[model samples]
Target: MDTRCNDITTRNKNEALCNACLIPIKENMRFYKCTYECNFVLHEWCTRLTTELKDYKIERDQLRHFSHRHPLTLVYLQQPNHNADDEDEEEKEKEKEEDFVEEDHHGGQCEMCNKEIWSFHLCYYYCKSCNYSLHKFCAELPMTQQNHPSHPSHILTLSNLVQSRNNFYFRSTDGTWKCSLCNLMWKNIYNYHCSICNFNMDIICATMSEQKINHPSHPHRLERMSGPIVSGCLACGNKHEGEFFQCTNCPTFRINLDCALLPTKLLIQNHTNGTYTHSHPLTLAYSYPHSEIISKYYPFCRVCDGKFYSHLWIYKCDKCRYYVHVDCATSKREPFMSIFLHESLGKTFKNYKEDEHPNLLHCPFPDEDDNLLKHHMSNQMEFISKQHDGEMLNHPSHQHPLIFFNEQTSVDKKMVSLHDPMKRIQLLCDGCVKPITTVPFYMCCQYVDEQCCFVLHEWCAKLPSQVQDYAGHPEHPLSLLPKIPGKFFGVFKCSICELQSNGFVYGCITCEFYVDINCAFIPKEITHDAHPDHLLLRVKPSTNLSKRYCKACQYSVRYSELVFHCPSCDFYIHVQCALLLPKLIKHKCDKHPLSLRYEPVENHISQYFCEICEDEFDPWEWFYHCTTCAQSMHAACGPLILQCEQATYAYDQQSVYRFLNVKFGGTLEIKGHSHRLAFVQGLERDGKCSECDTKLQYEMIFKCLECEFALDYKCASSFVS
Candidate 1:
């Protein structure tokens, strides 16, 4: 058919490239356009000349299949061009054979037969949009087969299992269909179904195709067998009588037919209105991990928080080392599937506007304006601004005038009102309550002889005096407070994170809401690797008393506190847990840095327990693990704080031991006790505080060196000089 165009637009010229040779079609060249509305064309003569070629495409170049969402286009693997100057024909033939059926790593596989597409050059119906392909023969199978051996009573219509089951509620044990012939769970691929009869036959069974299949989960080819093997199935860990596949190389490595056809990756979602979507695609693991250090063969399931038997197959994330039992991963309450529609999924990027705190209508601290203070990386006196004489009068946090110091020094004759200014002592910043190891810090210049008054980090000294409509507590504006007002002892529990701190706080007196300086600056939205698929929006506490738990550690934040919530997937993590859980940590128990594992992996040798605390913890909760040393421990036991060598903690009787650290192990004698008390720590250090009447193990405390007497940090500091 001769079709001539009088005028060609730029768009048509782009599509004018002949699909056969990839060369743009000129005005004089005869070409045939694709029948379908796609970017494909063929040189008229090239189509006729290729009929007898080795890699001849079917007359119909594009197919709209019921199995896939997009139209499948025809593609060919280019053959090596032969010429007069080329080498021997035998060598050329060998090269052609070798290249004939090479594997395409990213090409994926045929949805019809559940087999890898050996070569893109092989004639197949391919969908460029969805990365789906179908073998030419498999695609050409009769769409409706009547008089089939399995269920001959009615006509069977070809259907995509995933598409057909879109409305079906998924169950962990029954989310997919069981093949009528082989009795294996089937999903993701095509199936021949008689809807009225409620009968389904897998494509492999319908076509009676049983060949050596290359399963993505294993390295060796799997041979199809007719009977069940003695060993349990690797995927589900259950022994069932049915058709199965056994690895050709590893005789012991056998899996049921359903497991053999399981999709390579799955996306699981909580269907129970609970927020627990696993961030990464879970891959089917054929064998227990050989890569990580294994203390035991059974791992705890992330979903059910139950122990895994050694034989059960699992779907896991290699990056996070997250593991779950096959059933638990695809359970009805939290059903999972092999594929997802990406566009319908929520955005991963932050949707909330940037925090407007920087552009506040009123400055937090009127006296500590950016223009008023001078900052330097090091102790450079020359760099100090003329306006800043290293001193501030009547600061809100303290009664005494404060002077900034960049380094440790002996008593200075610059009119010091301090008691023993020459004495060396570790200083803690009253703002953050962290030890002030590095200077350019402010200390009370007008000190009372009884106690040192107040100290601050240079940055802490300039905290905003007030913030309005903050995300953490949006109901009311918060005024900065150096310490809790109307309380003799300034220690107060933070309203947001629920951690006790004597640090500077942003509080609203009317609401009785308070957050430490660190919590005050919590961003409205955060992007963490823990849930990389979506931004974690800061959610205000709910008035309802129902407990909401974190996905990572499975711990509950106080109902009155804020949480980092995934807007797209309903996943929730505690704000403090999200910020404090390190991806990797160094511990003395193992030489290697222990990586944070969201879920425990297989270790058949022993039961799960923390190496550091020597206690059992919820395996579903996040933990730090050293695969090299086979050491694992709770995230809390990994020593998130700085080492003791960085700064010595010296608490005086007059000041609160807010961020103070007592020398870990030491003996002290009291007036009434004959034996000295030694510092000890652990969950086992249980007893009421001698003076405070609180639990001793709740905080670092001292126990009697030879008796049962114990004193908490509050009481212990009272005895310090």
Candidate 2:
């Protein structure tokens, strides 16, 4: 695929040559040229990994020494080519044996060192399938902490267990964020770190035995520690689960793995000003401005309102005290990893028309022409909605800039704002007239005048201009655009969110890493009421990631949304699950009060059910319960409350409201049958809902009193909505 139709094999920069794997040929990596007129070219490794050479891939990756009693197992430098015709038993067995998977190290923790290995090159023996890991370069760390630059007064010592497992409260950020050196976040990397000075390091840095480190945390020498640690780390309150470094002077003081390994200096770019602000880059500082400092104190991270702690690595200006978090600095909205484009939108280069692109709208950025952008946007009152009401109002679909709707009718039937309406309408999103599933949508006459009656997902309005690393595609960045411009309005699907959209998309102009607005900037960690005790992390499995469901909602958001997972408990929650929800709520039904409760996962006593919705809910899911009525309802059924006795919240009343799905009731009119429907708890084994003709198992169904008419909650709810 070179620009020149030549059989040249020399390392060249201008030519994009390699064709076997379709990557542009670059210098240094050797490639072979074709002797024939077809002018085909391929990288040397690609040539060996081709489909025809599939059987030889394992042999190439693995090497047996001359005196080898056992074969040295090795993984591929990249994904090895697969054989499509490998239906034979031998190939199947080989596939099962290899399981060749490359793990994404976004938030994995090394069990041995208790430090995250963000880069694979940093660790030699970390396994993704299990928590087992050992840095090949550094086996057991060396002892004797003395003469370090960061600490110089006294010698550091080794200890075991930063804190006992029994006292694992007030957890440290040991495995949560990355090292002070790498600036990457890791959930678990294990090591004693620096015995004194409260310093932490990952396994890779521990291998550098020659350097005795000093840190500002203490006035002493800190060294690499060996053996199991048992005390709690002073820097972070959490008890050490793996290893720790202790201060020889202050025997009680300890530091975990993440702090000891921070780098002394970094030549990082100053993104805020786009310059190298100082002669020296940011320096690692252990003693930083504490929050208690007076006005003229140390610099704090603007991204996260936090001060620089010794155990935590914070970037600061070498010339000044300016500081920031590593993540907030490196994570600029630049696309680097993009994979979907290559596989999905292949003909984009052929079909793309720059001038006719839909994203290139008549509108410019708000910053460029604020007045014009506002004027261009239609300004009209909602059907009954008003912005910034005093009732702490929120739309069912949109969260921000919320309003209250007052739908009323005058004698002429023109329109008027009513303070309270007895019955609520089914809330619908203007984007599509579907009942709003996610909460806090836009309503009122303001949106009505805009032609979009009520409801708009907040993400649909406030989309980020760009996004960085998605689950895969770590090569190029993607851009958010308003779909492909012009006549070709082909249906498009977001790889992350898995929702089909013919609208705006976040796409890499260079590649096809595309996702919908809802999938952008998903939080990596979440503190949830669903799982009250521990923080849930976002884990994107490399394979079969499409099928994992959230434990709370008992659903998955395809590839778009991230899942908050608790590795210890093996619990999973959707990104939506992270949203702050109330504990108590009021519903229109038997109205004493209801408190939110998580249905126990394993309950053999009796299956709990939500009375209002009549939908079988996951016992592990959150629902509202009224002790008085001895009944439960869904938070989705109404706005939740902070406490049972607190003020009533009426699902943040809206003009277009979602109706509660009441399945089995006394008497319901049958459209096709001349009979009143009656609630039925049991019937023959083959009993089904007459409306949708689906089996009603272990749940109540609305059946005609005198005929075969019936309805299940799922179908019946749609009619009511």
Candidate 3:
């Protein structure tokens, strides 16, 4: 076939379907067509590239497909599943009998793509040695394509040159090709060039539907755009991209590409429940209703690890009753989300039934466009289990099913005995390496029976099989591993947190990266009294900076553990350091309840010292620095910060310290003493202090004007300090 008489590639302007690759022809692109009444054209590049590439490992001339194991040979014509070369008469008869009986064996399915073959007439690739088969589109579509679903009726001829033919093209980019559907320009590497219709698509979006899509954020379907519009995205209040998702039901609803394709659900590896399995899955959703009450709840998104803005989409799991931000699952701000072409099937084209596709997310080696890794850990409230069968737990993280026990006196497999005093021992957890004193841990009975000694914390056993974090490695999704190999083979320390945890960890085998449960599973944003001005952001402490002190405990904070820090205020604290003190609590020493104050204000009486523990307190650090009682206490000394009822009287700075701030004379005329005495800051010489009844130093003192006899602050008839 000859489309041109001469080899003048620049002279040819005609564009048509390339008969060899079945793709559109672009202007200035070389092609050949037959003049003998038959209109056939083949791209010049198609002639140079072999139909079957050389296999690096397997047989010669083997097509190395990403999805299949066997080498395939490209065929211009469609081939049947059964090879015509099978020559045995009996075997041929058997094959024909099987082919007729097996309705699915007629090459009605593209094995490599796992997609239905609409028709057998299309060109395909065939494996002569096996039953493997692939569509021609699947084999070649990985690199280049034209005439995509968007502007399906039009031929999107390749536009290698950035300059458009006509100046009438709206919203054109200087150095990039512009997409008609999205109304945005993209780098040549991420997009397919089209000059004829001035239509283009990003590399990933090229194969997707140009019409409608189902995003996890909105309940309604989204329609594709063909032109630029001035609208802000509902998910993120940004007006950057032109192509976006518009609601079918509402005109006001518009989502940018970044928001529309953002992952909404993920499995929560860190859960509130410390049991063998999390009772329910966690989802990203609004913690509060659409009202001003959201501020009262202090809503924060767990997925994106960000503070919540009013009226934004979040991933929510009904069962877990939790919400996370969609952006947290993937770091792809400019992702090519494939539209749901076959909406009649409910889920998008890439998504399948959850039960049938469990392994899709857990696969070690996944395709670049694989949807399973898109939101692997996004929980969808699919937690279904009988409470009665909790003793026989079925956890996703463990290979073998777990069995939990409630406070057993005797141990399984004679590992330890709780009955014998001589054999009493503290069983350290395999996951956290903390004492496993609490009941209800899921132990691997199969392994224990095999004498391997395998066990996990209840919460550790219930961790999600995978985690999805956008700011992490972009190439491969992180997978959960039971343990890592240490210098001692089985024993290992956490790469993050730096604790010697023999527990569950999220790891990327490809990158040789690992993070422990406490470090990996912590929420993205923490709303607490520790730093109330702005929500504390979870981040790895920088090694370049010196170790920071925890604001709560006044202890030096290490960079080994992930800490919460406010960039604006320069406030930093470790997760473990903040958990020490609670909001409010009551102690046996005092009848009234005490509240924790991060920045304890020093007053006239004492320098914010703990009355209970009798220790000096750090006014800037967290403590029960009482402004009302003019007394402070240590949260650690009391050790219990249980919630209690508030007093009838509310704390008023003027009213609470009215008596303490009263005017005092420099010399007090005591009724018991004969004369007026001078008030002093403290005693210069060794003397008794009534508060502690010991040798006084810096203790307030008052002396009689007539005698050398002195009285400490507490013993003085009319005290002054």
Candidate of highest TM-score: 1
lDDT by residue for model 2 (1-721), tens: 3223345554545364443334567766677775544334566665444423313323533422111123333332223445668488788757744653223233344344554443323333333344344333322233223554434453422222222233221135463534433444445434323322345444444344432344457787555455445555554333444445666566666776544544444544434343223333555555545552233233345333334554554566533434555433432211332321121100111222444433222211111111111221223224123443563345433334434322324213544322111123234333322234333444543443544334443333333456677554457666767554331222255565343444455677567667554455444554445444354567765445445556445554354345566665445665433432244444556556466555432112244555644654444445567766667655554431111221222333211111211112234564556776665342444278766677664334556666566677455544444
lDDT of 2 at 242: 48
Off by over 4 Å in 2: 1-422, 427-462, 471-516, 543-550, 553-561, 576-587, 590-595, 600-607, 613-618, 634-721
Q: Using Cα atoms with residue i matched to residue i, what is each candidate's TM-score against the true structure?
A: 0.45, 0.28, 0.29
| lDDT tens per residue, model 3, 1-721 | 1122224232254657554444667887886654433233456765444223322334443566534445677544322556567577778757755544211123444653344333222446678777677665555543334345565554442223343355222224554555555555554333444434445565335544434665545677777664555566777654455656678698788877655534223443433122112223434453235563232233334333245566765555453224444443333333333231111101112223545534322211121111111222235323422233656766554567666755664456355321111132324445543334455566665744654344555555555667677233435666777666442212244454343333556777777777655455555545454433345666665564464555555455554446676664456666544432345544554655567665424223224456643545444445564456666665444322121222211122111111111112256665555777665434335356533465443334566656656666566633421
Candidate number with greatest lDDT: 1
Q: Mark the 10 consecutive residues where model 3 has the least summed lDDT.
A: 653-662
Rank ordering of all candidates by lDDT, starting from the highest: 1, 3, 2
Q: State the lDDT at 280 in candidate 2.
A: 38
If ranked by TM-score, best first, what sequence of candidates would result?
Answer: 1, 3, 2
Q: Answer with 1 or 2, whichever has the higher lDDT.
A: 1
Instruction: Please tell me which model should have the higher TM-score, number 1 or number 3.
Output: 1
lDDT of 3 at 42: 56
For residues 215-281, what per-residue lDDT tens digits would candidate 1 score against the true structure?
6666788777643445477777765555677887898878776556455566656321233466556
RMSD of each: 17.8, 30.6, 27.8
Task: Report every candidate's CA lDDT.
Answer: 0.56, 0.42, 0.46
